[model samples]
Target: MPSPLTHDDPQAFGPYRPVARLGSGGMGTVYLARTAGGRTVALKTMHARIASDTAFRTRFRLETDAARVVGERYGAGVVDADPRAETPWFATEYVLGPPLDDAVELCGPLPEQSVRALGAALCGALGQLHASDVVHRDLKPSNVLLTAYGPKIIDFGIARAAGDDRLTRVGVAVGTPAFMSPEQASGQEHSAAGDVFALAGLLVFAATGRPPFGHGQAADLLYRVQYAEPDLTGVPSSLVPLLAQCLDKNPFRRPATDWLAAELHDGSGEFADHLPDAVLADIGRRAAEVWQIMPQRLLAPADEPDMAETVAPARWSRRRLLLTGGTATLAVAAAGTAGVWAWNERGGSGPDRPPAPGPSNRLLPRKRLDSIWQIQVDEDDLFEEVMQPGQLHVVGDMVVTVAPHLIGVTAKTGQRQWASNLMDSDWQVATDGERVLGLGPSDEGASSGKAGGDPLLVTSIDLLTGELNDPQVSLPEFNGELVGDQLVCTANGIAYVVAGRGKFVHSRFTANQTWYLFAVDLSTGKRLWTTPLPARRSGSVRLYFLSAAVVGRDLVALQEANDGTVHAVVRDTRSGAVRWDRPLAGVKASSVQLPLVTDARHLYLGAGELRALRLRDGRTAWESKSSRPGRTYGPPALKNGTLYAIEKGLGMVALDPGSGRVKWEEQGGQGVEADLKAVPVIGTDHAYSRRASKLWAIDLSSHAPTDSYRTTGNRFIAHEKSRTVISMGGNFLAAFPLR
Candidate 1:
């Protein structure tokens, strides 16, 4: 009945009653309070810390002025403010909905279509602000909100007039570094174009689950913003060109807000009516197919039956028989099937007689041969447990997966056969027809010679009966290679030990420090022989970075020297020797990792210089320079013979990998802050670009999105196939079915 207290320590003003404290920022504390007129409003009051400073008051006044100016132009008003109050407070329209940061955290990264929709919406708002001559100096996901109707940009506290002294001081840099513009980082003037640049950074977060510049401290990102180009490698394709335009280095070079608004909102008639009927049907068909196979839906807690908790598997009895002295034979058969046949046709007992119950056993139905059931091991569904999808190796019916955990499942029904309790951080799984090889560090660890850093633990199992076989191989620190009837283990790029047949063959790394190959036995720890050639660094393979593929036995590495030279090295695995070493021609401020792809004879690499080199001689097969300017962060996606490189600060370029000749160039959005950092993930007929919090599934045949997923929060990172897409952001992982 009485006026409720606002803050825990209330400091009431004339005719205003304080209630609960909402939140605090750098300059003020916002309180949820009611006025004497009985209307509730969010009252933001200056913090006592800065209330006495004349300069701080001036800045607050400027903020109030900017808000009023923008509101007048756009029909959106800042309701109340008292710049001269003992503790200054202002009230604006309180819109409900989570902040963009909270939205991304809750819903995961937005789809490509949703990103585009958000871009258009924000662009329209920016257009209105710019028309009123209001410059929003700080633009980031946290400052934006997705309301029920549309996205709204809030928190103009740091915004200033064109020539105000309210600029960030030398020791204090404002705004989140990941979203700051290059000019802002360098203490340049904050203009409408700066907002465009900040928008590009925001878009990168929307598309990639990660900021364009990431992982480092805030100062590092600030340095990168001032001196380096944004890494748009994960941004979606639909936003690639548009964002590139916005991220231009020179503010004068950026397009006006009106133009940007039109380009984003109207899409220049390029992707008009892009969703084809065939594409729509395929999406529906895939969804239906997956739904049908799902035995029971994972329903929420409110579901009546609660299948997730209540359903239990029927138990069955089993008996073992001695086969050959101590060897055991376990038999499983359906109890009901045997008794039903004996009762109806055999006529031994009537159904109503209640014959004595036999063994409780029921055989599971045989599963389909192609089924794959993956159980998410992480309770949070975080997907962090599974860093990357491991290679699927199949031997008859057993499909092995070496991922978050090592598991062998039946390829038919995704039923797990056996799982090993091996806590290995860095290990790989390989197999032969008769045995599975788990290559990992021994229990003694890398430093200890007993277990060996690279141990080869060979496990053998029956292909049909799922039984262990005799004669297992355990060797210390071995790179086991199959040659003839033995498994040879190589250690220290020097010694080799051969296993199988109880023989030992030894070899050592040649003194030449050049190229070397060794032959060894599998069964015993022994080396066979060694041939020498050149010394090799750990990271090089093809003698080309982002430009060459190390296929088959060759491992590719990119090494940067203090002198700023990038060396691409190729090493042959059969013999720990350098295959070739070549210099990659580019002045890279930062390095990015790229997966190597090759079609045997020619080695292909992606960057500004898309080149081909002869694998045997390290000679240039063909070379072509990229059309995009600035640093190239994204590697090209290769399909068939076509090489697609989505250049940073540039759009998509389709070239012939063999000849290094341009086939077609898709125009990208570039002005001041634009670039294509989001690498194009290509499929058979389509390619995807996940730029800042959006997803764009482009049809490679038409070079346009057949259909897109947008209209959500900013995206941080994404992965996709032709039919499926997964993106992770602030909180959850988003799953989408691609058409």
Candidate 2:
């Protein structure tokens, strides 16, 4: 409801004409104004005294930027602004509907669907701001407006970039106490996760008629927000767990915005459809009321020198957070007295945590629900204690993943064709572009102390059906119970594996173990070649190979010796004879976990600097020369005739394979945070890499990272046939667009 303007109110500001008073405060006044075209707007202005302060003017500019960061769809779109003016002002599209609190007061508690719709939309609005590293330090019911289009968030006057502390002061709490997150109430740096916690509180208020923490003096409210559990008595049963997780005390334990959005709704229908009929009617009535407002000034007595009235203005900004009560309120709360107030934003008991989690904090996903397709895996293995997690393989149009058991899914769609307990461990599977091969589920593969063992059984699977073909290979000499055995790789029509003949052990290598590297024909299950391998040290636990791949007529593998040193070993395909062996410099066997990157002419490897080794004689094809001392490169990835690798200080660098000359390095600082441990994935129009815990797309034409998507991927492989990028991490497997 708009009130008649006072005698001191200005008739007009620039082009907009003030029609009625909307609200007022110590810092600014909000008025109902109209442009020359008769379009209504909300005109907000800083007081002449406050505008004189340069710092306040700077914050006003930041507020305007933050509003634009949320964008027009989810927030009150900024129409115009002039922070440089003597009396700085900001104008925005006047939202037609009532504030959320007023709507709830008129329509009572919203039904479940309305609450879900509201929560999901708020998540999107907040997500937009969070994506740009901003946090709405003040998000409350009065800051939200309900419209026919959807809910709109406003009042970014206090918002700031995440991790920025230049404007905030110590010992002065800055948000509405009732709705503030625990960290915010404690004067800590409020992060995006804090916003999520506040969002859950808003949903709680919309579901019930009360705030999660019952209203009281600001002191008591802050205390409850910091130490007490949310009052979820009226929250729907289905949403209890989800909201509870969002309100978790530990910020790291709280769910992200995307996860909350997916859990609340599937984004099925129009937002208006979920609102109650009464609210819809109210939204309509308000639009009609905006045009009826007319300017009427309350004139003071003609000769009184225009003395101003001291009437308390409506609650609009931090004034809404004041604790009106007796002296010395609860704890060191931001209430009444000087000691209780907090003016700074320091997190934890000491220093503040990073706005985003650090690399060591791999306990949670940075974001969720951004994948093209995802499937929940319930991996249950017969030998659960002994079976290791498997790898992700793309063969033709299917993607095979294992979390102990093999699952075959269509590459384009995430539809599972078949799943079986046939595959036992990570090294039991191999692919040859057109065909998939793995060891059949044999109980004899489990770790045991029995002297004699069953024969190693081999099988091939149909790509479309996942059905095993008959005439499975069974070799008596190779014991199937040894956990260290590996089906390394496949090329042409032959499958290569390293098997041992000794007493079976799960994590230990016995002194009597005799290992053999051999190739078996998939069609006839006949042995093509066999060769002996060096014996392992007694009771050593390390496996023989870090990773292996087939290149032309040779089998190249990174083999770990008994001394725990990693060496590159290339063997002839015809007779399994060792062709060349060279020790890889400095790289640990554990750090080089991805498969060997090789092309027809050379094998690419390195961490400190990339080097291309000739396939013909393991001689150096070319080594990267560092332009600056101490600058280094991560592991290299090959695509088309170029090589991609992460160079420290610089981002993704492209090199010509033939001459080993620099082509172009990726532009933009986004790649400065690239995860060097994982391999860079090459797509059709963009090169993909893990940067800041998300899969970032580097535009090929501009040679700059253009966009990033939330992901939990540890390793990525692009499936060209399906136009999908397959990602695998922990027990999860997901996909994204290739280009």
Number of the predicted model whose lDDT against the real structure is largest: 2
Would you estimate the TM-scores of all the predictions? 0.35, 0.51
* Tens digits of lDDT, candidate 2, 44-103: 888767877878877777777677657555787665555545677777777767788998
Give lDDT for model 2. 0.72
The alpha-carbon deviation from the true structure for residue 413 of candidate 2, after best TM-score superposition, in angstroms, is 1.3
lDDT of 1 by residue, 1-739 (tens): 1123322333454334555555776898765555543334456677767988988876776666555544421222345455655566666544333456665665567667556656666776665555434578888888775542345576778886444444466445666688887777776676788888988778778666677777588888889887787777867776778888788888888877656655655542212122223323433343233212211122334535432221111110000111101112111111111111122212344323423433211111111111112222111111111122233444554555442335555544434454443422223444532345444333333343322122344444444433334444445434222111111222232222222211112111112223333444344434445544233332222111222223566645454443556666676756647778776777342322333456666666654556677777678887664443343535566777787776555556677777777777554342112224334556556666655445555666665455555412122122222133333232212334434
lDDT of 1 at 494: 23
RMSD to native, candidate 1 = 31.9
Q: Which stretches of model 1 miss by more than 4 angstroms?
A: 1-8, 11-16, 36-38, 72-76, 166-172, 267-739
